[model samples]
Target: MATIYESKTTEIKPFTYRTLLITPDENSEFSIKHSRQQPKHTKKVVLLNLVGRTSTDDIDSYESLEQANLFPLAHHIDNDKQEYEQYSKGLVQHFLFLIELQRLWKSEYDELIDLPRSSRGKFSFRKSDKDTHQYREAQIKALLEPIDPSQAIARTTATEYIGVVVKFYSFQIRNGYKFNKTPFEYEVVSIQYQGDSTSIGAYLGKDVHIKDLRLNLGKSRGNEGGALSSSHKNLNPITNREWQAVRNIPTNTSQVIKNVAG
Candidate 1:
């Protein structure tokens, strides 16, 4: 396959490949508005080339490959299908190994667990629905009995959208919740009102699913003493129970490095 090196000053990330495809007349679409435009060749390349199945020679023979049918290359469509499948299996194994290593480190260091404990500021808890007032009232009472009398914990109620799932530490929301009982260094802060999309990648190469974590100060709809203010009119409805984004925190990669090093 033909290789081209891009200048380092450009905004694109570096890419490595095993095979490449070059398509002519790329500017045809753009040229429709301006006939004098020149057509450029469109180039495609496969990264982390799989040996035998993917190579410099395979670029020319792709139209004949069955796997090429899946990718729309100019050569053979079935010739290297088996090799492609094997490559996929190996990729999954590698991803799982990385995830397991992350789990081991978190267990030993409790990296994510210490953030909330370190925050000395006051915060209220909230719920996702308001339909069951009696149940929520009792729940709030039970949660507050053990806190230091001077430290007041309020309940603010809110509602979650249909099909929205939250990940939170249940024990953390309950009185007598101790830091040591949490998983690895992770604790159940609350099953409260944060919104999360399906996890796209947390395990094998195939976008394995896992719990998505979020942090915020606001409460959801069903908590006691809730309010609707003019300021919240345009916030995302899915996470309306709380402000969609956390503001006022300084974010930097150095903190992640510290969490890892700790």
Candidate 2:
């Protein structure tokens, strides 16, 4: 349990890991109220560096960590083969997903009951199949729930992209949903949408998995995936989910501080 200190005039709240990911129920769903994934009076998320897994275990509490903004990311992909297999095979895209991370304000943690997990940027709750009803309904709601920039309680020291590669080589969007009105079979890479938002050494790390989609390790969609570590293959014994990336691999330390400046 976190210790709460009550003062006279103002509530002097002691900070904890739990404080960052908490959000309300109304803001949980994909609503038209917010244009971007800004903290709209509900969610307050801080990009974490998993102490045992990715980040260095030096500070014990969140307060100590706030004092020392620097956190360590593990360099699991040291070998050229590992890097080639991961990057060339498109496993790099898996590690680095879309920008919109889920705020646990309106949800529960699946694995870590206490700690919250961040959602990938691309996956959306607003799944549409050319339905007119959905579009009409969204427009009606938009009037009442315009994406109010004022409502977006952007934390002064907050981050946008949670699925950041410990160290990234490319920031430019290599792929897109449609190129000259033609759609590609593979996923188009969506890098930092807002210019100069996410930096290299800014975020903390977390374990993530593709919930619905199972993409090939290779970039182009051929047989690009390679052998998993002896321990990580067939993690569940029922399905062929390669749990090695999150389970075994270590995130590399990123020396980069500046992101794509617009």
Candidate 3:
């Protein structure tokens, strides 16, 4: 369902996070051993509370409305480009999962909404819009298999949740025990982004603490000599196996897609 926008003085709650799933202990060995492990599948579930307005008119029309409303509105009234795009993409994918689940368990679940028509052109839910649907379908297909309606429908459900936890740890081994300058050698199991200069969490392994990943918010690590050197950024050090698993993904999307898709 589209997000509801209320007119009263609204006190929006903070976004909540959750651990969807934990892979098998053996699969998690990549992080525990601080080296690349065999290519193994894994998954995790994350819950994000999206607070935004959705119009009955259609999501596509909002772009035009923004043009007409141009400058007079407060900055907060504007949609956060990154956040909104991310949320919508995620919501669409999750909604697709719900549809698939409903198909599988018709008696237990009902679809929240019918697919909306595209505002820009005549696009049906089928292959009419191949470019858009391809990505959305791929994302949804991955999710349907992993999502367990047995748990809460969404992460916010009060009961226990296990189906959402992510599994899969695949990275390559370079020089084995060495920590630096290894090709494709990073195993970022998890990340926490606050949208600030600091405190970008990257859990590489059970051991090996990297200070830059946990800097204080609004602070610059470069001033404190925590800036990663050119070499550090260049060395992916992943094994052929793990690299293949994440090969199709672009570097910039690696963390967010991995975390959110789970």
Number of the top lDDT candidate: 3
TM-score of each: 0.16, 0.15, 0.17
Displacement of residue 117 (Cα, Å) in model 3 is 28
Q: What is the lDDT of candidate 2?
A: 0.25
lDDT of 1 by residue, 1-262 (tens): 3322111111112221234334446665432233333332223222222122234434222122222122312111222221232232322222233334334444576555644222111221323212122223333443456245444333322112100112112223232334422211223232333334664544323222232222223444441322323234344554443343222123433221111111
Q: Return whichever of 2 and 3 wins on lDDT.
A: 3
Candidate 2 wrong stretches, greater than 4 Å: 1-101, 105-172, 175-262
Two-way lDDT contest, 1 vs 2, winner = 1
Q: How does model 3 score by TM-score?
A: 0.17
Alpha-carbon shift of residue 186 in model 3 (angstroms): 28
The clash tally of candidate 1 reads 27
Error of 3 at 136 (Å): 16
